[model samples]
Target: MIVLVVTACPAGLRGDLTKWLLEVTPGVFVGTPSARIRDLLWDRTVALCNDGRALLVYSSNSEQGMEFRTHRHSWVPTDFDGITLMMRKHPPSEAKRRKGWSKARRQRAAYEAR
Candidate 1:
């Protein structure tokens, strides 16, 4: 099975808490206040939708921010419009050190360096 996990905290607590939550699973945590809500919704055991105000944490619809659970592996954009997927990419194995990333984390250092 597949899951879209998300972690969210207040603006002041986003940094450390976001990282901690991600450590719990292969999910993403959104730091921005606006996006945090959306991320949390996605990270739940259920699906979510981006309504531009709050994220529909659990839904039966297949619209924006919707996570489809199938046997297929696919890629979903982190951000569409004002909504961002609170998802992270796992770090490559030791053999992939040359890739210069421990895992697929959009850390502040990495995001700011870009």
Candidate 2:
């Protein structure tokens, strides 16, 4: 069994997926297809995602008995203690380091030099 979910994707992509999977709801598809076809569909989805977010979940032999792939999503799949987990992308720090000394430091340096 496999499930696919897409957000903000092209209208044609939804139509294309309907050929192989059932559209259980808007942006959600469920189906059971051969491994080859599943891969092909995922590839097509990635190609057509176009800045949209997509997630593909399929049955696997892993510990969880399932595996998932994602495209253009902030949350990433991670491996922790032999288990697959979803982790959010960390944002960059906003505070930047200053290159030069402060006014007080400069004034102290000048006094010490004298």
Give the top-scoring candidate (TM-score).
Answer: 2
lDDT score, candidate 2, position 74: 84
- lDDT string, candidate 2, 1-114, tens digits: 999999999999999999999999999999999999999999999999998999998999888999989998888989999899989887777468577899999999999999
Error of 2 at 101 (Å): 30
Q: Write the per-residue lDDT of candidate 1 for residues 1-114, one digit (tens) a residue.
A: 122333332333323435433323433332323345544433432322221112223233455534433111233336566554655446556675575555556585688898
Error of 2 at 13 (Å): 0.3
Write down the TM-score of every candidate: 0.17, 0.80
After superposing candidate 1, which stretches have Cα over 4 Å from the reference? 1-65, 72-94, 99-114
Give the CA lDDT, 0 to 100, for residue 14 in model 2: 99
| Candidate 1 lDDT score at position 82 | 53
lDDT of 1 at 1: 14
The residue pairs in collision within model 1 are 5-43, 6-43, 28-86, 78-85, 91-103
Candidate 2 — which pairs collide? none
